[model samples]
Target: MNNRLRTTLALLSLAALAGCRGDREDAPPREFFPDLDTQLKWTPQGRSEMFEDGRTMRQPPAGAVPFGRRAGVSDAAWASPWASERDRFLRDDPAYFDGTSGRDAAGNPVFIEKLPASVSVDKALLLRGQERFNIYCSVCHGYLGDGKGTVGVQYSPVAADLNSPAFLVADAPQTKDGYIFNIIRHGKPKPDGSGGFTMPPYGHAMSEADSWAIVAYVRALQAARSAATPTTGGSR
Candidate 1:
């Protein structure tokens, strides 16, 4: 063959060989599907990191001490300074909060005490008032209208002496049933007292009928406090 024809044939042969190269990218990767020899021999354990003669090794021996051991876990305890406890949490609370049903046996809402001289109520209402007062008020305000309740002794600012006439004096319009109703609905907040703690507002806790009934009973309590105890100071 002439030199040019022979060169052309050689170039054509090279292109055919190039196309047959299964190792090229478009050919499915040999690494993707391993041959029998590679599959049997290649394994994760086949490769390993070697420690050269003078190189510092990273892995510690099985029983070797950890260098610069991590700091020990702390065992210190902590508690909040302002934690508050409930009355039930401590048995010392005398009242101990026996709850009221807020209703009489007849299903009518009732007060925590008795009716005043100005107003008369049925026996059912009076009985219900007595029960409510026994549940709520008698703990701080005495059952006898003396403000000397079993739980009152524990108070930081001593309980008011309800037996004294002056206690009612400041409650001007004290005679007014409406004023009593106001006090019951929106508890009297004491501004000057040792405790700004007022009686809890019954506005949300009790119905209007119940609030008025409580006012009526409280007036009775007030009247009881005003009751005279005749003192015949030895016939001097």
Candidate 2:
């Protein structure tokens, strides 16, 4: 071919390549496979003609029960030998339900001063409590129950020291098991009701039995810490 014609052809080929390339900086690329986008489907509150009700959604089957819930179980079936008599005293005993002990001279409801009758301190119970405490409470309370946990250290307000005398009321009076159970079930709120950094309640996540177990574990930790500390006169 002639030189002029070859040069013209090269110029046209370059222009075509430039057009195909387009601009590097632009909007996001279009979908390569748009089949999913175009597929027919019914979204929430959408209508459909397949059902007699002419609605896309249908009600759940009658008597349906959610996970971890009992529907038709009887009280007799749930009762255990380990359950405290106070729990069985009335239909719902205050000790098991509200964590109350006995009323003082005042009309106020006095909280129980000890562990639930159902819970007995044993090796197995302590082990279970230890496992649960490490999983949930240890994040803020520390593995040693010293309130120096990783998250607690960085927290704005320091976490409570489970081993501290104030925690178990060691000097004035011993701490009550029911009180601890209540705290675990209903989380501790901040001094002010502002509600940002307070401990979250574990009632929903952990069962009542498990909550008791955690309380047991905390008591064990306190006992151990007390024994380890040296008295003024001699070592523990």
Candidate 2 stretches greater than 4 Å from native = 1-91, 102-109, 168-174, 195-197, 228-236
> Local error of candidate 1 at 47, Å?
95
Which digits, one per residue and each the tens of the lDDT, describe model 2 over residues 86-186?
33444265676666775679876576777778667788988998999999888888998899989877766777788887865553333877778878887
Off by over 4 Å in 1: 1-120, 167-171, 192-196, 229-236
Q: Each candidate's TM vs. the true structure?
A: 0.39, 0.55
Root-mean-square deviation per candidate: 23.1, 15.7
lDDT score of residue 96 within candidate 1: 17
lDDT per model, in order? Answer: 0.53, 0.74
Tell me, by lDDT, which candidate is best.
2
Please give the TM-score that candidate 1 achieves against the real structure: 0.39
Residue pairs of candidate 1 with colliding backbone atoms: 114-217
